[model samples]
Target: MRKLQFIILLQFSILLFAQENEMKWQEKQYPDSLEAVNKAPENHIILFENENLRLLKIFVAAQKSEPIHSHRWPAVMWVYQPSDYEQVFYTENEKAERIPVQTVAMKKNELPMNVGFPVGKGDLGLSKNLGNQDLVAYRLDFKKKIDSSKKITKPTGWTWNEDLDGVKKAPASHQIVFEDEYTRILHVVLSKGEEESVHTHQNPCLFWVVKSQPIEYSEFKMDKKGKLRKSKTHQLPPLPTDQLLDQNKISDPEPPHSVKNLGTENFEAYRIEFKK
Candidate 1:
């Protein structure tokens, strides 16, 4: 009887340990931003956390001369640098190999097992669980335990909508490149030699760059009585402030301004402006 009791206790202990391990294995969705990116010497990683601090989105960034490493978790990474390279390894087996990442823009691919993703200048590639970069990433954690039956989805990543008043064009068609979602997201794309007249928005806002380019910007702030206004612009200011590499914040009473695409290629930007 004593031996049987001891065996029963051991089984209970094992069951408890297994339950704990299962609880730690959770999945979630993450926001898109630079803060979500985890940077390391070997590579760059991004983590998306839910409202409860749950890991959601994962990204990886790698430079030349990097090795093919294991991706313990599943993720999607967008490559920004390097033009040509390779991911050399076996998908079902463990071996070192090279895999080319050079392809058309807007290409999405999933990598299985350990593989090398070659990158090039102005090339963007997406992959999962790869690299050892200690980079910060946008994260979303769940406060309460989630159900496996529940379906998870990601946000629009970035989108644009008209203002509350249904105004598509700002004060001036030339001044406002594009305006939408007075409270949420606004996207603007400018081609080379495109310029807008001076104007302001209904609320405070922030500008984010979706694509790359050499561009210029200018802002004119109007004072009370509409007489005292100042004009200023900067050349691709630091990210999030000038160009959003990650997250952004816009306060109420949105400011007004005009922008122009000074680069040879077209400019793509997103703005999150607060509504009254």
Candidate 2:
């Protein structure tokens, strides 16, 4: 009898813990506003939005915090200027927990680089910048539900391809930073006056300007004999310090183009290519 009683007590305790955890998750509510960029324009700016994707540029000043906001869609964050930060999650019981999120460091052109992580839909609480430098990043929010059938089966690998165009052929500066079944992320850095080889983009993509600057754009065509023929040339207006340029099937028809750095500083960006 005593053994059975103890077993019942243990089960009750387990159930209570489970319920408490569930309540914590429930307390983190999703905001009704579907567009974060519109709702929180101070920190979140919508660079482009469509049926499939919503690209947002996020900036937070040093020693500041953003108000409570929720993300309803799964998104990938590309951190351009990472600093010390904390994400607070609240519970219905008025209890709060802090999660310390940090960016992973990688090497680009033998220089240290940092990148953000993928986030799921939930109440993300306040984002507090603890570091002295301002935080700048881009978030690629998917508007549609994730399709499980199209998920990547094999492990993603990083590679540096020289034949890629619209950027310099430096293997160290251009690399595949991240990849999954649904998306591929490419990191490119071009020095001043450096030209990217003529290349074509075949997939719908989000171009994130990490370190924004002026650029010269030129379109060209390849003959049947694999010779390049210049068609049009224009100067692309300087983008904001941190912005995202969305290109869809209608806008990007896989035409060959090249880009040259017209600014004095280095041009850096991340191109997120979507499989869908």
Best candidate per TM-score, number?
2
- Per-residue lDDT of model 1, residues 1-276, tens digit only: 875565445345434533442343222111122112322223442222334322222323433333333323322222222232333321211232224422222112321111111111111223333333322122122234435454323123312222312134443222232222322344455677677554444444444454556656675554687552557777763222233344423323333455666667766554444342
lDDT scores in order = 0.36, 0.62
> Candidate 1: misplaced stretches above 4 Å?
1-167, 170-183, 204-206, 212-216, 221-254, 274-276
TM-score against native, each model? 0.34, 0.67
Scored by lDDT, model 2 comes in at: 0.62
Which parts of model 2 have CA positions greater than 4 angstroms off? 1-40, 94-116, 148-173, 208-210, 236-250
Query: Which stretch of 10 consecutive residues in model 2 shows the poorest summed lDDT?
Result: 103-112
CA lDDT for candidate 1:
0.36
Query: 90-142 in candidate 2: lDDT tens per residue?
Result: 43333444452322222222221344356655544556777787877777787
Candidate 1 residue 180 C-alpha distance from true site, Å:
11
